[model samples]
Target: MPKVVLLFTGKRKSGKDYVVSKLKEMLKPEDCSIIRLSAPLKKQYSIEHNLDYDRLLDSSPYKEAHRLQMIQWGERKRESDPGYFCRLATEEEDKPVWLVSDCRRLSDVEYFKSHCSTGPAHPSCVLVRVSASDEVRRSRGWGWVGGVDDGPSECALDEVSCDYHVINNGIDEQLDMKLKELKNFIEYNNNG
Candidate 1:
């Protein structure tokens, strides 16, 4: 069967992990497997930077500043490699449905475009974006107080351009509804 990957993104504490976990539960063991790409980068970075993994994960720089470091390192490791995230996603060929959490940039989108197979005849790819107000995001544990257009400053301006947008305003029930909608959307569009 062709694979279906749900590419999700949001600012830190925008409930990206929570939403992805919800989808994992909804999809179940047989329906899909949830794969997180940032884990590998987090681990490697923790080791190199001498920072606690859990502590660094919640840091805004972890996604922005460290992501650049990771990309540069990955480029040296392999000249066309899109970094550890894409590499990991490609390794998960056995799963029919994949929930790809934490997509961050246009490069990440293009990496998925090149790595994922999508068509009317195949399972396809679904890109869903999650967002929240700066207040809500900060309240939910977003590391940085100010949003930035680039680099490690918590909020990135381009997140609105993702394929599907979900506003996570810190309400669990609302988040659930949006995720359910996403699940239905994917099934409906990829059923062929």
Candidate 2:
């Protein structure tokens, strides 16, 4: 089990990936790992659809074109097994600190809390919500898509309480401070 598991959730273009990347940099590379749940999902989708798995992982038009369908496919898999993707994401993670860069549902949180957050070896799971105004996201190339934006994958955790709330609106100083606080929290928990 990891010493700390940081589960992050946010809307598209809300900088969840960016913030997690920065957080990873703050910690020693060998001690931390960024786990994306979508990677496995996309890989499976790509294989079944005969699409390019690498292209589906990026934030490009190719990914956007298949986003809704991919979400639906993932949802169906989750319906049968809620922890399907969660298990795949963390199966091989051995780092003491796990930064789950994209946690889209309550099931994802439950999976980590139930599986990884238990025992004396690890601290409780931390849920961090990275958020930005729609305007800011739009400026970052996010445009509302009907089924994709309004779907469960995007809205499942909208009202879920989080351990930390990060407002990423292009304010470097503020973001840095929050991230530092988070890094400190992780260190404290790990050492305790």
Candidate 3:
């Protein structure tokens, strides 16, 4: 069973990956594992589309070029199975703390919520949104794609409420403080 689950959702180049990496470093010796939901989806998408999985996984011009097409393909798969990638990502996760680092839709969070938490009153799963400004993301090499930036896969959880909203512009003191508190939260809940 998942002792503590953090469902993370964010836009492209929103420091979601970077923040999760920090969480991994901070959750030390506590059996924390980061699950990128897109990994399995991208692998399947790459196989079916005859694309290079390695290239698709990287943050390169190659990935940006194929982002729209992949989003379309992913939407088709998600329509058929919303929880497909979620389940695949967590299949081998044996750790007590799970950080789902790339949740793109409401369904993704809902899937983990159902699987991780026993009841609503004593919820074990936490939804976290890591966001960086468009200017900041652009500085970090993020350019908007038409279909992908505007589509359901990327925009589905934008308006939803999250337990924690982290603004990761430059890992300033405020962001560091929040992360510290989050680490404490995870450790307390994971071993309590």
Candidate maximizing lDDT? 2
Error at 56, model 1, angstroms: 4.5
Which lDDT value does model 3 have at 89? 88
- Relative to the unseen true structure, what is the C-alpha lDDT of residue 136 in candidate 2, on a scale of 0 to 100? 99
Question: Model-by-model lDDT, in order?
Answer: 0.65, 0.93, 0.87
- Per-residue lDDT tens digits of candidate 3, residues 11-94? 999999999988788877558889999899889989998999999988999988888888888888889998988888889889
Off by over 4 Å in 3: none
Give the per-residue lDDT digits (tens) of candidate 1, residues 57-88: 66565555555565445445434555556676
Residue lDDT tens for model 2, 2-74: 8889999999999999999999989988889999999999999999999999999989999999999999999
Model 1 RMSD vs true structure: 4.2
What is the Cα-based lDDT of residue 142 in candidate 1?
49
Ranking by lDDT: 2, 3, 1
Error of 3 at 77 (Å): 1.0
**TM-scores, each model vs. reference:** 0.73, 0.96, 0.96
Preferred candidate (lDDT higher): 2 or 3 = 2
How many steric overlaps does candidate 1 have?
A: 0
- For model 1 the local lDDT of residue 180 reads 84
Clashes of 3: 0
